[model samples]
Target: MTDKSEYKDSFRCGYVAVLGRPNVGKSTLMNHILGQKVSITSRKPQTTRHRVLGIYTDDDAQILFVDTPGIHRKEARSINRYMNRAASSSMADVDVLLFVVDGTQWTDDDELVLEKLSHAKGKKVLFVNKVDKLADKEEVLPHIAHITEQCDFDAVFPGSALRGHNLDELTKTLKQWLPEGDLFYPEDYITDRSERFMAAELIREKLMRSLGEEIPYSSTVEIEQFKFNDKGILTISGLILVERSGQKAIIIGKGGQRLKQIGRDARIEMEELFDSKVFLELWVKVKDGWADDERALKSLGYDDYR
Candidate 1:
């Protein structure tokens, strides 16, 4: 066998940022890679509002992967401002940048990402995501080449985030790019976020998934309590805050049936995540245009000063 020092020189460690436009499966990809729910997933745009870090480690390398919000060009608004800044700030002091894009097209939105990636300090690897829909995987090469021409990157990878396809290679490549360094987090560890935050996010995800777009976008979930017992029982109370009383009625539904459904679904997933029985209570309250309120935004953890 090679000497211990020689072995150390061959190992790698670094940070990889998963970035893309809204609903491009960036959150799904992060959850899949980390094999846990570090970020929330939704069909809606700008689902992730914070910088989520997921750690991956093996004998040959260690990776600190940052899951960023969907990279979108936006106008004045509290939500947009925070999402944009959260995603952008993760770019600093990173070893590599993984600029994720939907593989199906080469829209103007993609060009905007290219512009942002152009200014990033480190090397990049472009991933063409959502490839499961392709009639033939080979069809994306032309688009890949087009992006490659515009942005200089170490390599271009094509994969489906929804499926497990190409993830092994992508992970291997990302590990290879990093220089030798100490592990950032323990091998068994996966994410930096707390269970409380994740519980609230799961409630939000259920709302977004079960309810229609109009209500989901106008919604936010806050956790009031999260406690568990050795008997494998967990209790979580969440506030489903909406923008209007009309929306609140829609959320509560007939005899509070809709709220029950949302809580049921969220609790099931929480049980699976925590490996315990969960008692989830959901309350719907109209925040009355709190989306525009700076204090409401700050309380929800969208404080841009981070």
Candidate 2:
């Protein structure tokens, strides 16, 4: 163990909430920064439903990156409301707020996120993600300029989360903004979430990736069983909840092949993450209108933001 007394005076540590609209690469940025996948990601919007912590620690600083759900205009369902709340509440009590936007293209949802960012108390930083996708490189400067005019930011950076562009500079800038303090987590700890929570998220990521657009949004995962056997084979049983029987059928697919593939993909990732052999079981259950049901949402672990 390293002695805390050596670096106590100069060590920097704080929470940095990564805020953005859906599909802007906020989760991807944090995952890349931490050099691991603490938060799950997919092309689908609203792929991240919870506020996941990605801890990055070096010799000088420990950056607690809070990967939040994207703030969007949609609040029709209880889940949507929960996601918005999760994103908004994360801004509170954080040392820095990293507001990410897509390259050169801003939407109504981005405006909504900016509006939310305006009221936040933390030192705000703007990140223009996916800049590599831009056709004309000159467009980056003017686009960032336009956004900075709308609201004040401590710093701005244009980078591609997928391509690992300018991320080292971003990390260095974030460290400067954090307050000097003792470490919030152990040096080896990469995230604040438990293995069980990560298991549920890993399963959910596979669900989102495997199914079509509609089914992914209408579903959530619950870990029914998680344990280790005598020979150290970890066993996990996941119950996937969907809104209707028809959707459930689609996920399970013809001859249970789709569900089997989802289980296989999830188990492989789980094994790599847990560093042990895994026995995975999956079942789909129809939980009608759970997404819109407030009580059901609360029971399904969506009430953490409150």
Question: TM-score per candidate, in order?
Answer: 0.92, 0.98
lDDT of 1 by residue, 210-274 (tens): 88778887788889999986876898889989999999999899999988998888888898888
Compose the digit string of candidate 2's lDDT tens values, residues 121-238.
Answer: 9789999988888899899998888888888999999999998999999999999989988888888899989998999999999999988879999999999899999999999999
TM-score of model 1 vs. true structure: 0.92
Error of 1 at 124 (Å): 0.4
- Model 2, position 156: C-alpha lDDT score: 92
Give each model's whole-structure lDDT.
Answer: 0.81, 0.92
Best by the TM-score measure = 2
For candidate 2, what is the TM-score? 0.98
Candidate number achieving the greatest lDDT relative to the actual structure: 2
The lDDT, on a scale of 0 to 1, for candidate 2 is: 0.92
